[model samples]
Target: MPAVPGRLRAVCLAAAVAAVLTGCSSSDDGSGTGSGTGSGEPSVAETPRMTLTAGTELPLDAYERSEDDVYALAKAQNVLTEQCMKRYGLAYDAPDPSPPAHIRPNARIFGLVDAGEAARYGYGSVARTGPAPTKPKSAVLGETAKSVLFGPKTKKSGKALAEMPMSQTAAEKKKSGLVVNGSPVPVGGCLRESYLKLYAPTSSSVDIMYVFNLKGEAESRALSDSRVKKATKAWSACMKKAGYVTAAPASAARDLGFSGEAATGPGAVTAAKADVACKAEVNYAGIRFAVQSAYEKRSADRNAETLGLLREQAQDRLRLASQLTS
Candidate 1:
């Protein structure tokens, strides 16, 4: 129920790259202000929550998306875009989709909570301790191709959009759109065609992140639950005893000042180990994860219909993707 970093997201922007990108990287919870009746779990009678069995740690039975679902859709969309551009004598090469995190979704969200990471660099962006990833080389496009696939930049503004008030005739508007090769941009624009081919018109409106955001909300709520509060207090005391005064995992990481090359040094490693030790002693993560997971199970049960629709759309898009490639 910890919003998996790559899984939770808002849906409105999904129209542009939901299938491809949500499948790529992630975060968000849509709920506004809580009732704020804080400091404990609600007194209402609760459903008996299940504990983490090997099979039940994640409530995946409600729905799931696999790496294949994302990769296939991305590759297929690229293929379509490439072919469309070929027709207009433009070279189009789509980059390979970014790799998914190797850890479970929850692990990616919490980041350095991974034992290896904690032992190594304490808490910080990996780049704090090590070199950043190399940028992948991308295909180069010509001016015509860029203008055709993306709209032509306005000559006056040097931007994709024109000065709204300055526009007048329909012909000028059309001219502003594209001048691909020697013809108008192919129907629907090359990128739009590729997207339509990979996803349903209706899916353009669906929020890919709804389920994930709900998971985030569950996490937020769990943070305030009485059980979590108790565990957090115990963890805080342990850290304080070690001369590290911090209330929560995030705060501990921050107060440690995990920036620059110093993050990988002796002091940082020592504090990180203590942080991990405290978490284990208090069972803070275990309790929090369990509480949030229960919340997610409840939410998934309640929102099964909408979740099903989103999953089906992803499946359908991937199916089309496969066919397109085949």
Candidate 2:
């Protein structure tokens, strides 16, 4: 899916989880949570703690951004627009980029402690690494083009145009009530018609809002969960020992002066590696992942009906995307 520029990244949802970290205890080995069932270090390890694996499809994660569908839909819209423009003896062109192979799940709490990530980007992975994604190219349609692609405006010249009411029937919907750019604009514009064909097939608004606010509810809980606080404190102390003082790995990565390409370079390799090492040493990933998962599970149970509908629409969109791409 095309990403809006300057979109805020995902944050920790650890605090949202309602489960208590009962079995956890601080281990002398520096891997424990420091408080739980007796002993210096926690007797039980991360294994006993609930953790999400790839085998699971958590509710929030199941709803994905169907990039392939979005790109294909965009192309379809462009083609439709081109045909519409040709009616006026004008040419239209749009460039659609291929979708990404896969988007990584949020790691706001995990902090890239994954062994593979540690071996690669190191501390650089602590923050979002690499440049922002490129948006697919599409012309900024002018009034005439907009009229051709969407619907005509009520006037030949204006800053805003009033939209005419739409009818349920296709033929009726095509009836024009307003003149835009000297052309009659229909109730339900052609552009919107094309969009409907590829997405929102059920005309369900839940499908729209589901993807729009995927993790809003659950993540908020996790961010404030006690488990998250404990994990962050431990991770912060570990980072301080490495000579970096930050509340979380995200904070370290967002320093601007020491992040991304700056810290990812060969010159800063050691620090990058150390960041990952500290993350593992303090078990930040384990703690946060478990806590967040608890919250997500709770949310899934509570919003089953709404989420189920959203999931169906999401799957429908995925199928449409596959058909278009194929």
Candidate 3:
């Protein structure tokens, strides 16, 4: 999908450590309570603990866009980009912004949380759990359209553009001198222009990726946290008892040598089931979630001023998106 610069990059960075660590830095679990079950030892819940399923939002969710909102923003941006292209006498159709219904955004953020999903798909996707995906829009762009949608095709300019941040890229695009049919291509092309129109809008715009970057930082810290280490070690032992030899949940899929059809085969299903079972027994997800939350809370506290501005900007961006799409 054609996206604003940094959106997918930030998401990719966050997902890179998806199975390893994920969390918010706050102590509150969004429940009115001020604490969570982060203790190193496992304890029986007096009542049923809410299963940390794909639909469960982490504490950091407050600072980020929801999956539906993401799709809405992308669709709105597509409309704006197409309009911009029309002004330059170019045709542009951005890819569909719809996401799969069954697969929630946080599906694998904790990695293989659902035993039922594991039993059916193993390490494979939960595609079978959802409706057939919508056919994507054709994204073929003529060389002219490409240059206009993006920027100049010169190797030197391409190299420079690739390294520059979006803000700088937008500034440079003004003097790019790459005119199309007597019209100057907006900075970074129509794609970038549409992004700026909704997300940036001004030179002082707070980076949309700021909260995402902070979450990534928290995840990194949570990975090394003592509480997390203890819980994971217990999980590893639990896995070992179940005849799996993985040292950590993150490495379990890789350690079990399986590929292609074998990945979702009986053996894969068995191992995945064991992995999820061990995680539950050791309370791995809850512990890690808590640890990451604490880290994120500290990060958010330190950056409160910037985060406040970013939050306002994000809401305004959504309002503008609604206006554009409406």
**Top lDDT prediction, candidate number:** 3
Q: List model 3 lDDT by residue over 1-326, tens digit each.
A: 00001110010001012243232332232333243233222211111122364665544567777656787898898998899899888777788776646456566776787888899999877774545568887788888898778866567645324332356345554555678899877656777777877777776788787777887877877787655676677778778788888877777888887567887999999999988877776667766655565555556556778877877888888888898888
Q: How accurate is candidate 2 locally (lDDT)?
A: 0.51
Better of 1 and 3 by TM-score: 3
Candidate 3 pairs with clashing backbones: 24-293, 25-293, 25-296, 25-297, 26-297
lDDT of 2 by residue, 1-326 (tens): 11101111122222212232334333422424232222222212232232223233334565545555555656666565455566555566755555544444453334455555555655564443334557767687676666656664555664224443322234244555555546564444555544555554343435455643546655665566655676677767776787876776666666425665665665355565666666566555665555455455445555678877766766665566566446
Cα lDDT over the full model 1: 0.54
TM-score per candidate? 0.68, 0.64, 0.77
For residue 293, model 1's alpha carbon misses the true position, in angstroms, by 1.0
Candidates ranked, most accurate by lDDT first? 3, 1, 2
Worst lDDT 10-window in candidate 3: 1-10
Better of 1 and 2 by TM-score: 1
Number of colliding residue pairs in each model: 2, 20, 5
Candidate 3, position 40, lDDT: 27
